[model samples]
Each structure stands twice: as structure tokens, then as C-alpha cells.
Target: MQNDAFMHVRKMFPDLSSHRHRDMKVSVATEIKWVVFYRATITTRDGNYQHTIGQRKTLSFKDAKIINLQYCMGVCTRQLPCQNSGYTDPRECSECRCPEGYGGTFCENMAESTIPDCGGELNATSTYQTLQMEGDFQAPSGSSCAWRITVSLEGGYRSFYRTLLGRSM
Candidate 1:
């Protein structure tokens, strides 16, 4: 309800700045006011899309609740890394703006790994209790060979695989 509330809102939405006047009252509600103000500013553009949360004048207490105060208040001034290579406009919220290619609450998966070359081999070695390796495929014998790459952990009990297509002669 103090300056901290407004600070929390600003922390959540870095792209938005309070457009309120200098003499405006500050309280817990003030954060909602600024959210409404900036939510209008950014979304009302000629071609900008309105956010679902911005469609209403007043949100239910649950909707307006500051769900993650710890995270928001703790890193108000920090530019946190996006989970999955999401784009973060410096002027916008500290949260990552995930691209279409990435899909997750935090945009964790952004790019697909490039398949290894036909003749390339990926080998991983470890001196620990078990061994681990990840890379491209090894050299091929002929034009008509299919390669299946498997990745195993230290004990070799957990394994995942991908099938690589064969090259045409």
C-alpha cells in the first residue's frame, strides 16, 4: 500500500511507466491504477493487440493479486534472463517475451538442435562412475545408411534416441 506497491507493479511490467501526475495518491490500489494506465498506453496503439488481462476496467481481487511478490520485489531492478531464449525488450517487463518458435510459461524451448552430418560421429566420454557423451553421428559406410543416435546417462539406464535419415547416393 506504500510506494512499494507501485514499485511492485513497475517491477512486473517494466515496459510500463506510471503516467499519473506527481500529485497522485499512492497506495496498494495505486499499482492497479498504473497497470490500467500503461496497459492502455501500450495496447491502444493503432495495431497493437489488447492483452486479455487488460480488457476490463477492474479485475477481481484474485485476478489483480500479486501472485509472485517475492520474485517481483526481489528483482525489481534486475534484467533476468528469459527461460528459453525469449526476447526481452529493455523497455518492457523483466519477464521474457517469448517468440512463436518457443512455447512455455518462460519460453524455455526456442531453437531446435541441428541434426549431425551423415559422416559425423558424436562421442562423449567421462571419468566419473559412468560415462556420458553427446554430439553428431559417426562417419557413414554408404549412401543408404540410417543412423540412430542414442544418449545415455552415467548408469546407461536412462537413454533417449533420435533417428537420422539416410543420405541418397
Candidate 2:
């Protein structure tokens, strides 16, 4: 790998100096559409029997136990994990976040904050709600993302508690 691939990479990326260490990569050397993929067939005899299946790329930039796709998978048949680190479970991500007033691993643990308040019960279900947002703002206000949560108490059992993680960006 260091003999041929390294030379090719050095020629392709001139910015890479001799002292700098580079990462290994995997890519599709050619375009191939499993001949053709039809309902229940995987034909390879193009002119004759052809299935209609799509193509996939096994592109991994790093040499880890996992595969990657930074260039984005056009039509991947198999689901791939993201290349980002420090991420726990991407799926099943429903957990109460402990903001400034609280702190912990999954944001599940809470503590008293410098911002004093008449503490009582935090009813998450009734006091707060969840909303989906998609956008990045330049300024603040109407665009400013500063927000605080409220608590609603129904009885011995708390109901409403909300969290706005990562200021709207």
C-alpha cells in the first residue's frame, strides 16, 4: 500500500509533504451496477438477463474496524454509520438533557444552578414541548437562540419538562 498508493496520493495531493503522515483510503475504481436487479433476480448477463439493482461504494478514509463514506453514499443498499466521533447511540436518542442548571453524562442528572429559582417539581410532559427546526442564523433574537425551560406540576407525578439543546444554529 505504501509503495504504489502513497506515490499516487503524493502526486494527487501536492500539499502533503514527505514528513506528514497520510491516511489510507478505499474507493470505487469503476462503476458497476450489479448487472441489473429485478424483482427477485440478480442477473449479470447484461444483453440478456439483467436485474435492476443499484450500486454502492465501500469508501473508508481511515483504517478502522468500521467503514466510512465522507463523499456521501449515492444509493447505498446497506445502512452505514456516520464518521463523526463522541456520539453515543444515533438511534433511540430520547433522553432529558441537563442544561446549565444540570450536568451529567447523558444530561440525565441535575443539580442546583447559580441562577436562583423557587424550586418545586419539573413536569416535562405538560410544561414543555418539542419542535423541529432546520436552519443557521447569523444574528440573534427573532434569530437569537437563547431559551429556558419551564416546569408544570400536575401532582405527585411530574408531567412537563422540555429541553432546547444546541442553540438554534
Task: Estimate every model's Cα lDDT from 0 to 1.
Answer: 0.31, 0.25
Give per-model TM-scores. Answer: 0.18, 0.17
lDDT of 2 by residue, 29-84 (tens): 11011111112334466522221223236422221112223332333443433212
Residue pairs that clash (backbone atoms under 3 angstroms), model 1: 1-28, 14-93, 15-92, 84-108, 120-137, 120-138, 121-137, 121-138, 122-136, 124-133
* Residue 10 in model 1: lDDT: 35
RMSD in order of candidates: 24.7, 22.7
Q: Where is model 1 poorest over a 10-residue stretch in terms of lDDT?
A: 12-21
